[model samples]
Target: MTRVALMVAVMAVAAQIAIPLPFSPIPFTLQVLGVVLAGFLLGPRYGATAMVVYLLVGAVGVPVFANFRGGFDELVGPSGGYLLSYPFAALLAGLAAGAAANSPRGRALAVSFGWGCAALAVIYALGATQLAVVTQLPASVAVAQGVLPFVVFDLVKIGLAAAVATAAAPAIASSRA
Candidate 1:
């Protein structure tokens, strides 16, 4: 639990470094990658807790969110819903991956990657819905602007996270022996 909290804090701080985009309000961030990795490594409860802590820290004015901007106002702003949904995303990913880990034919990499994709989809769904509601944009436009642009990058992140998680699992299991 402590380890997970520490990892989340570190990731949240890391996410503050943003690559500002040309037109989108969504900047390129390491947060999604971190969230996926948390799910893959920490299991469901810890992963969700980590994400919740991350959100809480940001909400408390830690300036640890994307773009180095964090406050209560940000939590209630246009991007708030996405931020809020992060714990659920991580929880779903972790649950899926954890379930897969119990199967004889399950490869951790494949399972983690698959779950990461699902998590990303959930995030996009929540984000797009909130964006449409807040901005009064059509759903198609919201998806185009908020979701499409990030898909490829997110997939790359998922793949990387899965690989890392897969490679680490045996070591982790062995260490406990």
Candidate 2:
């Protein structure tokens, strides 16, 4: 419960460190780092639970969303899809982390890398779909607007998250033990 609370606060703090994109409604945020880290550290169920809490709190107008904006409007607005995708993304990453945890360190790292890619894919898919639907933009346009610009940065985020989690995994396990 304390971990869950901590993750929620971590994510909210991360959300505040946002850079609004000039051309896209989506902002580049450290939130994804928090999301991926939550998954990598917490495992699937707890990871997803953490994300759900973050979303619900933000949705209820906690000013926890990016740039200190929150509410139903922010949740369903243009950036809505990205916000909505967080739990699923976290779940995917956490499941991978859990699966890899039993393997050797190298194997675990490889799994983290693979899962990072998959998590990013999941975020883009759900986010692009929402962007297209809400903005009435064509699929290609939506992809361009919402996803293309962020691929490299997101992958880097995932990689950094994986590394951080891998380094901390042993201690994390110890604490749980």
Query: Tens-digit lDDT track for model 1 on 19-101?
Result: 87675566778777888778777777888899998888898998878887889987776677778778988898787555666
How far off is residue 162 in model 1, in Å? Answer: 0.6
**Clash pairs, model 2 backbone:** none
Position 163, candidate 1: lDDT: 83
| Candidate 2 residue lDDT tens string, 1-177 | 888889999999999988888888888888888888888998888988999999899888889998999898987777888888889988999987677787787888778878877878888998899989899999999999899988888888888998888888889889889
TM-score of each: 0.90, 0.96
The candidate that achieves the highest TM-score relative to the unseen native structure: 2
Model 1 residue pairs with clashes: none
Q: What TM value does model 2 have?
A: 0.96
Candidate 1 local lDDT, residue 38: 81
By lDDT, the best candidate is: 2
For each candidate, how many residue pairs have backbone atoms clashing (under 3 Å)? 0, 0
- Cα error, candidate 1, residue 154 (Å): 0.4
Please estimate how well model 1 matches the true structure, expressed as its whole-model Cα lDDT.
0.79
lDDT of model 1, residue 126: 89
